[model samples]
Structures are given as structure tokens and as C-alpha cells.
Target chain A: MSNNNYVKNLIESGMRIDNRKFDEFREIEIKTNIIDRAEGSSIIKIGNTQIIVGVKLSVGEPFPDTPDEGILIVNAEFSPAASPSFEAGPPDENAIELARVVDRAIRESHCIDLKKLCIVPKEKVWNINIDIQVIDFDGNLIDAACMGTVAALKTTKIPKYENDEVDYEHREGELPLVDLPIYVTIYKIGDKLFVDPTKEEEEAADARISIATIQDGKICAIQKGGTGYFTISEIERAIEMSIIIGENLRNLFKH
Target chain B: MKEKEKLIINRKRLDGRDLYEMRKIEIQINPIKNSMGSAMFKFGKTWAIAATHGPRAAYPKWQQNPEFSILKTRYMMLPFSTWERSKPGISRRSIEISKVVNDALSNVIFLEDYPKTMIDVFIDIIEADASTRCAALNAASIALALAGVPLKDIVSSCSVGKIDGEIVLDIAGFEDNYGEVDCAVAMIPHEEKVLLLQMDGIVTKEEFKKMIMLAKEGCLKVYESQKTAIKQAFTNIIDIE
Candidate 1:
């Protein structure tokens, strides 16, 4: 089937190939503490697609531009084994895009208080690496990766350090660095927008937009993808929907 | 060094379980509502979740045997599951286990009942210990059962190994590293049929037989525990008096 025909059929049915409405999402399942070695880790399943996010922390010099603040690096990789289209070696455009979308959502929202991450001013600060891996590609990998990243961050705890020597005791006293920042992605297929597109919808999608919002209805980041275009009104509608979706997602992490 | 000498010297294990004992096993089913079936299985420090989806229609143009169903399995471990950071992906080890699990499950699933349909079983390991793969397979089986997938029988799995040259029922991280032999077995308790078996390291045929027998015994125990978990889950939904 040609790509154009696929899109036409999908829009006409008001459903993606997987039978999900444009506003509907593939079933989502989130599991935290899936990674024991990382400070925080989570796995998000959106339909058959799976993404695992792990957060690791290290003490390092802060970036020159933000010397007083800590650093947050988001790296995303799509394993060649995940799908036939993903090749080995450096990240492809899709993987890079996934990382940028997730990173922008979290970083732009200032999910973690960078100042708190700083321990010795410019000399040493916490470098939080959020690594996302696409384990399976059934569809909508970016949304799943972002959700897992936020959940992992929310569940993450930094160890208390005083004199560089490790102290296993007195663990609970140190608080987490920041509140949770949630991400919601909406895909435009035909004339409608879907909350979370499955793999099939993703393949047939004309355009996709992701919005990252903090708790107070503030928009932190926005990303637009695909060869398709959306009108200004469509963009506004997506942002409104994202806020509602983001708030509900935020509540999910609270539990 | 003599085998008996090695066994006598190492009296204490890392986690302190007895040689013949198994790790504490905790199984939770339907932790998530959206999936057809979902389960979290913990064996001591190791943890994993399994989600089952569909007897949904198979994709067009894929290999289809009209008389049987297709079972697809994916096993993955999160980077945080280990002491060292791991990249998220389907590693070779996980892929091998996926194949084994698919093979094991096919034996018990009444595939002919769901012709031209597909069942996708996904197992994600959140924490890692020595026997994560076996735990994943067991958890997947339980999740499938909870999902109410038609099956000839429910399956359970366990591992046994020779640690310090002594036959141990289940080997944790420390023991797994120093152990001389490792064997994992998946079985259908009611049928007393072994569906999958894997072993590594060195052991005589006699020892292999013993290890397999012990693993089967352990699998039976696991099966009973899984049954109890399933019953509890259903009872929780019964609108109890």
C-alpha cells in the first residue's frame, strides 16, 4: 500500500491501523526500578514498542556556560536489533530526534533544580545522564521514552555526600533534586490529533508535535516532526491538549 | 583441588541462603490495567515484569500456519538492573532467552485454538541477580496465564547450579560467578514435561541428571506459588462477601 493511501484510510476510519482513535493512545504500561545499577530506571510500553530509561549521576565540572549549575545530558539510542531499519554504529536521525525531543521537554522545563545539583560551585557538580534505549519498535517510541525518563527522574534519589568519602548511612535525609516534569506527544494524522500514536499511526502520521509541561501549566518545550504541516490553530489545540494530558500524566507519577 | 574440599570451605553464601534453599519469590499480577495480562516477579533482589498482549489478528503477509497461533517473545534488561550501567537493547543473551521462552511456551499453549492470531509476550527485567532469565520466563508464563490465554498447561521454570562443587537449588550473583555449573529448566507441572533446558560450565552426566531433577523439583514449587498468586488475583476481583 502506498503511504498516501494508508493515511487516507486511517483518517477516514477515525482510527489508526491498530484501531485506536486519533485522540486515543496505545495502551501504556510503566514500570520503575527496572534497572538496579542506575540511580533511577523505568520501562515504558506503548503498544508493542518498548523504551527503557536509566539515569546515572557523577560528579564533574559544570559546563562553561552554566558553571554554577549542574549538568543534564540526554542520550538516546535505537538498537539495531530493535528494528530492521535501525542500523548499528552512531545514532541515526530518528534516535537523535528522540533524544532532542525528550531532552528539550525535560531541560526546558527545568525539571531538576540545577543549582541544587552543584556541590562545589564551578569545580564540581552533578552530571545527570539520562540514557534512553529503544528496545522494541512497535511505534511512538519518543512518547514512551519521555514518559519513562520522567518517571525514572521522579523516582531517582541522589546519595548524600559530604567529604568525598562514601557514606551509606543517613540516606533518607537528602531530598530529591526537583519535582517531576511530564511530557505529552500528539500526532497529527489527516485532520485529527492523537494523544499517543502507535507504531502504525506513527508510520502513517503526517506531522507530530510533543509538548513538555511542568506542574503549574507552564510549557517548557515543544517539538514538531514529520514532513507534514499544521496550521497555527492546530498547534494551539495541540498545546491545550498537551497541558491536560501532561497534568494527568504528572498525577500518574505521584502515585 | 578436590570437589569435596571446595564444598567444605565455602559454608556461607553472599546472600546467606542455604545450599538447597531457594530465593524468596514474590509474584504480583495485573500491576498495570491496560495490558491483557501483566505480572511483576521478584526473586530475592532480582525483579522483572511481564506483559502479555493479544491473540489479535496476525499482520498480513507474515508466515501463517492457519492451524496454529504465533507466539512472539522479547526479553530485555534495563541498564539499572545491574551493578554496572547497561545500555538498553535486546542483547544476544536476551534474544537467546526469548527464543527459548517462545519454545517453552509453545509446548503448553493450545495454539490451534487461535488460528492465524498472534500472542506477544514481553518481559522486562528491572533488577538483575543470577537467575534473571529463568525468572523472566516464569513471569511471562504467569502473565500469559493471567491474561487467560488458552493453553494446554501452565509453565514454571527454575535454575540449579553446582556452587563450590556442591549441587545448589538456586544460585544468586556471588555463587553464579564462582559456581562450576549452571542449569535452567522450564516445565509443565501437571504434565511433568520439560519444555526447555539450558546448562553451562562443566558437570558430569550424572551431575547433570541430578541438577535437571532438582530444577524440575524447584519448578514444581514455583508452579504452586504461581497458582496461589493467580487465585488471589481472581479472588480480588470476585466482589467478595
Candidate 2:
């Protein structure tokens, strides 16, 4: 309790243990096309938090609700080596939440233009599977995972499909993208809110909100987590912070 | 599927509601006699029942925490609840919804009061149309409150969607099938704080804010019905005495 109070007091007094500004994110480094065997892959590191995302394409049937659109499935795994809290088994709620949030951002934004992936409408559409792995333990996994997923998708190329057969030896054109979505998460410890929290800071935080925005400051997805609440003004501030940070992060992909 | 029928015509939904209107809601308390607390909440065509059990001993000893109690929420949709038969059993979708609903209520309940204990809330979707999660949350919150669990406030929930370039409240039926976006919100009304928020689909930032405002108003209305149901339940008990 005292440790929690100590962290909260410091944050409320306009200071972070890491000396970062309230809205500042840790140094981000995103590397794409990290795996040659995979169709697309990326490794992203925000401070000590590292995540890798790889995209795999397969032929499958589309869901009934979206018969004309291709299928997109996101799966995430937290390696036991990443953190002591994570176990070596199937995904728990945290892992599921991480994957779902990233999936919502990508799927909701219509970034992939799923229509183009459709080979035969409901019969034989290209199913895009994004697998995210947590390689290091830190905080701000959501932001890092989202960035890595986008990076991987940006570098993705469709596998050659001819005569109802996928040819691994051949390559097709680049993956069509409609818009780029970037996620920015803000953690609230006390009255103060900050971005890109470390593990220690995350432990002391009361609540956190993540917003995923597209190029024109449009919000595609949102999630509020933790056992604390945020007042109306706090939420508003978080949204503004998200938009500014998202724009800056989105700019990295232009190159 | 039928010639791309319009969802909204003449500024009104097919169900005869305005853009900012929600479905008629109904609440019933203690629907399950043997449970600690239980309630059924209905939003037009959608219905859900939630039951709360235990601040009793924690199970699986390792899962117990020494400092505070734990809250677990399980959300399920019956096979017959939807238009088509959904496979019976816990799916990934249910697991994710359970986690979010648990988070939405964990803050309100004073779990620290009962160390080494756990509270389990189970919600079953009895019928479906749209906004099922929102309905499930509304039922679960009332069940927790009725169970005599110490709480800061009751959580109310609703969903907002955009259809044909217009934002509408409490999507159902045709609007839900063709809506461009669906955003579900759960909040503490008096505190003006949101507890659970999940959204999918596309909307600009301005439209998003408008949806939040509309959701808050919708939740407030749900809160009124909840309060009334609780009062009626207590009154019935007094008459039984």
C-alpha cells in the first residue's frame, strides 16, 4: 500500500520515476520484414517491451455474416520467458484481450480492404491470420503489439494463388491498405495520466484507456481497463492525447 | 439480403423509434429463487439473466488473494438465443466478454472487505437481437446490488451505432444487421465515469464523442428502471411479511 501511495503521490506532483513528460511515449523502434520465411513480419520495441507479429495467408471459407469479405483472425501469445506472471499454456484473458483489441482496430478500420482478398466470394477467400508474440516483459504491451501488427500488415504480400492452388515459391502484389490505424494508450495513476508506462508504473496505475485512431483522427476502436474509473474530463483528455500521439506514430509508416 | 432495404426511412427506425431512442427496457429481480441474487433484464427483443453467488471461500487455493476478493464474470449465449444455432460451450467470444464484464464491475464492488473470498457472476443470454452485452451488463449489475454486495454505484449499459451516415441509439434488428459501427458502453451514471467501453467499426472522432454522450443518456434511462425494480422487489418482501 505504501509503495502504491508513493508512486501515486509522485505522479500527482508532476513527476514520473523515469522523468518522462505526462504524455510522452518511450522511445519506439519498429523493424519490419524481420522473418524471410513468413509472408510479412515485424518486431517492435518500445523501451524494454518487445513484440513480434507475423502474417500468414490461407484459403478458407468466409463467415456467414461477411460472405463477400475475406476473413481476418488475430491470435496472441505471451511467452513464459517474457514475464514471470505468464504461464506456458494456452492464452489467458490478458492475451485474449490484447489480440482482440488489435483485431478490432484492424478489422474495424477496414484497413485490409478484405474485398480484394476474396477469390470466390464465400467459397474460397484468402484468410489473413496475424499472430502476435510477446518477446519481452515490460508495460505498454498493447501499444507495442498494435504497432507491430500494423508494421507487419504494411509489409505483407499476397501469396500467389493460381488454379485454386497456393504457390509458396511465387509472390504477388502488395497487400492493399485503405487506412493506417495507430493505437495510443494512456495510464492514469492518480489525477495525472501518462503514456508508455513501464512495468513498475503500470503496477501503480489505477486505470488505463487505449484508443486506436486512423489517419484523419478518426477513432476505430477503444478499450478501458483496470479496476478504476475515469471521470468525463479525464476521458476527454485521454482522447486528445491519443489523437496527437497517434498522428506522430502514423507518420512513421509514410517512409 | 432482400434488395438492400433501407434501415431508416423518414428519420425513424423500422421499429418506429427516432434516431436518439432506445428500445423499451424491462427488469425483474430475483428471478432465480435459490441464487443469492438474480435478475432478468430485457431490451426490446434481447433478454439476459444474471445470477450472483458467493463471497464465499475461494476455490483452487492458488487463485485466492490475501489482500482482496476476486470477481469473476461468465457470459454465455444459449444455442437457441440467436437466429441460428450457436454451439454450446465456452467460446473465445464468451471468454473475452466475461473478462470485460468482470473489469466493468470490479471497481464498483468493495471486494477488499472480504479477503480470501471470491464473487462469481454468471450471465446467460436468453434471447438476442442486438446489444446483448449491454443487456447482460445491466442484468449483472442489478444482481450484484441485490445480492447485498457492497458497491459504490450500479453500472448501467447501452450501445450506440451508426447506420446510413446517421448515429442512432440502442441498435436492434435491421439497424444492427447493416449498421456501420457498434459501440457498447457501461458507466457509473452519478459519477460521470465510464467503467467498460468497447467499440468496433468506423466513426470519426466527433461522431465518437456524440455516441458517448448519447450512450450516457441511454444508461441514465436504464438506471431509472433498475432503481424502480429494486424498490418494487423490496416492497413485495414487506407485503409478504
Candidate 3:
């Protein structure tokens, strides 16, 4: 059977290959502070797919427009070793998109108190680098990456600095984290919406909408991907699903 | 860490495991359907997954050998697998590990049976505490067997090393970093053939002999798990026709 048939059969029969109900997400495993050298790091596994998110801190000049605020840079690398389909090269479109969606969740939500990161207004500020890597591509990378990033940044530590120089060996304090951003993605297949599609389901999905919500179920970011169209009713239902499902994921992932 | 207690105290290593104890080993085959064969191999906190594809015609055509099939392998650790986030990609370290793993499998596989074809194995690390290369080799062996690839025997591998002046079996991640020596051994237990043998750090001749013996014992235990894993996967896979 073709990929389409495989998915259709499952939908017709109910549940996924792993026997998960259509609306249910895969089992998630999160481990934070796995990287000692980096200020913060997390490894998240959604079913078989896994992603590593690390936060690196450095001193730099803040953007002119945001002179007193800290900077957040999100970078993603899809390793060829993650899957046969991935190539050895710079970040591809998929990687760039993964980073952007995750970045939007934290940035747009103003999860971090950036102004406190400024050492001197317009002169020096903390440049926070978030690097995400898809180490296993079993699917559902976006949700996992977002969780990893949020968890990592939550645990980030700012290095101690004195006399205008950072002491790389000593950590002074934790980053000023104010809110938690959670992402929930729902994939559409043959009119049905599902949470956390496996790689095969993902390949056959028509379209997917990702919603990022902070505390109190407020939507902060929305991204729609894939070539398929979504009905107005479907979008509404998905947003509802995002809030309900995103809450559960966030609670379970709490540090 | 105290000098004596950091590694070994009363012959028990960190995590309170005996010097001869191996990590808890678990294997799940065919976790993903896209590949011909796949396995999720877990050795305690160190976890890895391997997938095998091919015996298909070699790509680019020119890479095919008329008399034997080519085996391609890639090994990578997740950035969060270690204390520090490692850069993801095929680094010099991974390349070397992949090459050696390929070499270890070459002798056990009946590559000559499938001429003008290629078999690709990819290993992805989820969490690594140490001896990932050996774990990859063991996982790849199960994946190949699950894919119905012809094998002389399923290969089993393990690492032995010296910590606190005693040779130990199945070194964990931290022991690998702080230990004095590491010797990885891969074998076909029934035939008792050493397909791969590599080591690093300083060792005396007597210690080398002892390490190899301990490694062989560890490999045998791993071989039993590989056989049972492949058998279990097939038992659930009933014939359709």
C-alpha cells in the first residue's frame, strides 16, 4: 500500500500505528541540564523523534531599536545522521522553519525579561543563542523542539561578570524568565485533526497548524505548514485542541 | 570525588555497579516502518536507535561492486547526549567510529551474496553515557538481521576498561571519560571470531589480555540478547499468506 493508503487505513480503523487515539500525542520524555558546559540544555523525545536544545550566553551590543534589551537568536541544525532523508549541509528550509516557530513562541510571548540582561544601555547586552538539533526524525519535531527550548531557557544561567569582563568559569545567576511558552501542533489528515503525527503520518498529512500559548491559555504564535488547506471550522477546532492539549504537555514537562 | 571512591570502592564502580556488571540492556526492533529494519537499543541511560535499508542497487551506479555488496554506516550522538552539547554532524570522531563499525560488520555479513547492491545503516543516539560506538554496532547487527540480511552470525559488541587499577566490563559513560584504558571487542560468539578490536589509553600486556577476556564475556551476554531480540520480533510477525 502507498503512504496515503497506510494513513487512510489507520484513520478508517481509528488510532495510529502505535495505537494512539487520533487526538492523543505521542509519549514524551524530557531531560534537562544534560549539557554541563552550556548554560542550559534539554533533550526531548516525542515517541521516537528526539531533539536537543542548548542555550549559549555571550555579551554583545543590543539591537539599536531595542537598546536596553537582550537578544535571542534561535538556530537549528538537522543532522544527516538523524535520518537518511536529511543531507549534510547548512540549515535547510525545514530547519529554519523549526527554529523560527520555536523562536516566535518565546520571543513574542516576552518570556524573558530582556532589559535586565543589559549591562549597559545600547553598549552591551546578553546575546542568548538557542541551538536546536533534530537528532532523531521520527516526526513531531516542532512540539518537541519548542518544549526543549523553553525548558532549556528556563534553566539558563548567566555567567558572573565583574570589572567589565565575564567569568566564564563562574555562573552569577539565572536568566530572568517570566513566562513559559508552550507549542501544540495539530496535523490534518483526511478531515480529521491529530496531535503528534509519526513520521509516516506526517508524510501523508495534508496540512498542519501550530499554536503557541503562554500561561492562561493565551495564543502568542500561530504557524500553518504543508500544502493542504484547512476549513474554517477545522481551524477553530484545532485552536481549541491546542489549548487543551498544550496545557497537558506543559504540566507534564514542568521542572 | 574521592580518589578511591570516584571510580571503584570495594570493586563496585559508580552507580554502585560491580566491575563486571553491564548496563541494563534492552532492544526493540522495527520501531519505524519506513526502513526495511530498525531497532531501538538501550543500555541503561545510553540509548541508541539503528535503521537498515537496502540490498538495493547502489546509487550513482558506479559505487556498486560486481562481486560483493557494499555496507554504509553512519553514527551520530545527540548534542545533549553528553555533559556538554556536542555539535551535530559527521565529525572526525563519528567518521572514525562509523568506519570501524562498518569494518566489524563486513566480516560477519555475507556481502558477496548480494553483488551490485548496498546496505545502509544509520544509528542515532538519544542519550549516551559511554561506549556508544559499541552500542551502535550491537544495534546495527540486530537491524541487519531483522531486515533478513544474510549473516554468519549476529554480531555482539562490548567495551572493557581499567578504572582504579582494575579491569572492568561494560564501562559506563563517566568511566569511559576518566578511565585509563578502553578496549572494545566485537565478535561472533559461536565461531569465536573477533571481527573488531580497538583500544585506546595505556595498557600493559597482561592487562590487555585480561581486558580482552572480560570483553569476550561481555560480548557473549550481548549476543544472547541480540538473538532473543531478533527472535521475539519475528514471533510477533506472523505470515500473512
Candidate 4:
């Protein structure tokens, strides 16, 4: 189905599929330390959607290009178990896009001081692997996953090392990553713009734009997806809305 | 004593657990605002998340049973969850586990209360160590509880394994791989009822009996932990009652 009528009905009523107003986001809930084995982990909930992110660390040779800095890899998997549409195999394009967008937000925002991950100069650096698993898909997985990732990273503590071995038993201090970055996704349905579209709105909307912002209000990354195109003015409007949402989210991580 | 020395001298055994041993266990729960319930579980690094959606309508004509509510389960692991990520869709292992979890849970749920409705349980494993399937079953039970889905019982589960020729409770990833026998059980403590019982590898009937006893002990311990967590979750909220 084209969902044209559904989109038109929602737009005409000045409401979203989930009955949210134009600029409102879905309800969000965050919980950390849900994964006991992960160095840092968080589960994020946006309405009916759920994403779990686990952060694990190990020592490995840094990339030759970024030998002085640590390496961060973000992998997002939308399992078939999450939804009926999701197929069995390697992550398809949707999963890849989700991971890349989230990766860019964190990396571009310079949330973690990659240099601090260095264990022994150019020889070894902490390889941080962020694994994101989508356990349920109601809608708007990107925002939920990104938020969960950032929260997990914020709570992460790189264990102290001495004499080429991790001091697992003894405790040293924690080094919190520097900046906190957040992402907000907006969907355009007809002439109306909606923040944090639900699965229904997401299915009905013509085009979607996700904008990630750092605390400084700088655009870290922007991805425009779906079949529809937006006017430059709409893009500007989305950015402004994202900034407001990002600021609100920034306050959330402060605690 | 001399036989003990022989086992430890080379630090190797038919089953790998040292004396006074247990397996690694991991637990996680994601509160998905979108879903009715959600949780992740890891046993010896075998990871799975259970998500529940709806006491909604029953779909497809034949699948519905009017006398009792339906419990539909899908158990799957992402390709990346294992050392080698498997195919994404329903694998044989997942299908089997789904059936096992469904059977385990059906015994505890009062399905007759919600006739004609359907409760869907989806479990996805992001990684596997050992006892992943059993851990997933435990996680589903907790997630359902968190969702506030009424049930007649709280199902708790764990695994027991034999290593170094002795029974050990809760096999960790390493111990499970090298252990002689692995047995997973799900039970309702209040009823003292066993829902699911599965075993693999090697063990005599006597050893199997011992393993069941040990697994039950582990299950009780896990049940206590689950209670603590549930209490803690609700502690801060104002009690309506």
C-alpha cells in the first residue's frame, strides 16, 4: 500500500499516526548496566522500540592511519527476531545505515578522547567494539539505538593496565569520554514534519531526515533517507528542531 | 586423593570444571517503551533478548485455539552472536529453542484466562557462549514479568555441567565447551514443577540425577536474584496499594 491516504489523514488532522503533535518526540526510557558482561551497556526504549547496546574493550594494534588514537567500531544488527520483514543473513542496507549514522555521530562529535585509548604509544590502543542489537522494532530505532550507545559509552570505564596486563582486581580511576553527542530524526509527511516518527508514521512518511548534533550545537552528521526530498527550508527547520531536542537529551546524560 | 592428583597434575579432565565450580552467567533487560516487555540474557556469554508484544488478536484462522490463549515464540540469534555469525532468519537451533521455551512457559502461564488472545514472545540472541538457549528461556520469563503479564508462576532456569569428573552448577563458556555433560532446566519454584529439561554430552543416569539436583539449586538461587531485581525496580515507585 502507498499509505497515501493514511499520510493524508494524519496531515489533515494535524496529528501523527501515534497521535503526537508536530514537534513532539516519542516517550523515551533508558536503562544502563543491563548487560553484566559488557564493560558498559544500555537498553533504550522509544515508545515500543527497543535497542540494546553493549560496549566491550580489548587491546589491539591501532590502524596504521590512526595509530596514535584508539579504534571504535559500531555494529548494528536488526535481527529477524525483531521484525517479520528482517531476513536472515548479514546485516542488510538498513542495518548498515543505522550503524554508520550512529558511528558518525559518536566519532564526528569526538565524544571519546580516542588518544586516551592508547595503551603503549603507537604499538597498542584500546579497541572498543560497540554492538547494537535491535530486540524489538516498533519504530524509530535510530534515535533509540544512538541514545543507548551514547549512554553506554558514557557509563563505560576503561580498566587500568600495568606491565602489559590489565589490573582486573585492583581499581584505578575512570576516564569518562569527553563530549556527549545526540541524534534526532524527523519525518516529512506531505507538508507536515514530525519528530521521532513511530513505526506507522515511518511507514507512511515520504522522506526522513536524521540529524545528529553535539553539545556545542554543531552538526556532526546528517542523513537523508527514503524516497522523498525536502526543501532547503525544511532541512533548516529540522536542524533547528534537532538542536532543541539534542539540548534536552544532553541534559538527560548529565545525570 | 591420588586420582584427584592425577586430574589436577595435568590440569585437564574429561570435563573441564575445577573442583568447587560454576558456569558464567550474564543477564540484561531492556525496557522498550514500544514493546509490552523486553529483556536480554547471557549464559557463559551466550546472549539472547526476549521481547513480548501484545495480548492482541490471534492471526490466521487455523492457528487460533479458543479454549486457551496462544503463546507464539520465535527464537533466533544474529549471525554475529556466534564466533561465526549464522544466517539471520529462523535456524534449526532457534526453532528448537523456541519450542523448548514455549513448552517451558506454557506450563506456568494460565492460558485459559485469556482465551482467543495471543501473546507473542520473541527471543533473539546476539551472542552465544553456552547454555544460550536456557538463558534465553529464563530471560523470557523475566521479560514477561516485567511486562506485567499475569502468570501463575515465575519460571527460573539454569544449567549444570560435569567437569573434572564432578558435577558443577552453572557452566561458564569455557567450562561448557570442555565439560562432559550439560543439563538445562526451567522450573517454577513455588509449585516445585519442572517445565523444561534438556541435556547433552555424556553422563550416566546417576550423574544425571545429581545434575538435576544441582540445576534445581541454581534455579532457586537465580529465582531469588530475579525477585530482588523486580523489587528494586518497583521500590522507587509509589505503591498504589
Lowest lDDT sum, 10 consecutive residues, model 1 chain A, at A166-175
TM-score of 3: 0.52
Native-to-model Cα distance after best TM-score fit, residue B119 in candidate 3, in Å: 36
lDDT by residue for model 3 over B1-241, one digit each (tens)? 2353468877777798988888888888798789999887777878889999998999979988999999988889888887878998876567656766777777678999999999999999888888787789888998998999998778888888888889999888878767776667677755555555555544444565577677778888988888888878955322210
Model 4 Cα lDDT, one tens digit per residue, B1-241: 0122333224433246444344444455555557787766655457778889867778875767788779888888878876655887985456546766786777667778777888999887777777776778877887888777888767888877776677777766656655555666677654445555544443444455566666667777767766655555543322110
Candidate 4 segments exceeding 4 Å error: A2-4, A167-175, B1-241
In angstroms, give how far residue B144 of model 2 lies from its true place.
Answer: 1.3
Q: Model 1: which docking level applies?
A: incorrect
Cα lDDT, all candidates: 0.73, 0.88, 0.80, 0.72
Once fitted onto the true fold, the runs of candidate 2 whose alpha carbons sit more than 4 angstroms away are A1-3, B1-3, B234-241
Candidate closer to the true structure by TM-score (higher is better), 2 or 4: 2
Q: Give the clashing residue pairs of candidate 1, or none.
A: A22-A194, A34-B126, A35-B80, A35-B81, A36-B80, A36-B81, A37-B80, A139-A199
TM-score, prediction 1: 0.49
In candidate 3 the C-alpha lDDT for residue A91 amounts to 77
Q: Write the per-residue lDDT of candidate 3 for residues A227-248, one digit (tens) a residue.
A: 3445444656777888888888
Q: Of models 1 and 4, which has the larger lDDT?
A: 1
- Highest-TM-score candidate: 2
Residues B1-241 of candidate 1 have per-residue lDDT tens digits of 1233244255655566677778988888787688899888877878889999988888763756588788888889999998887888975457656766777777678888988888989899999887887788878887898899977677788888887768888777766656666666677755555555555544444455567667767888888888788888854321110
Which of the numbered candidates is closest to the native, going by highest lDDT? 2
* Predicted model 4 interface RMSD: 25.9
Query: What are the models' TM-scores?
Result: 0.49, 0.96, 0.52, 0.51
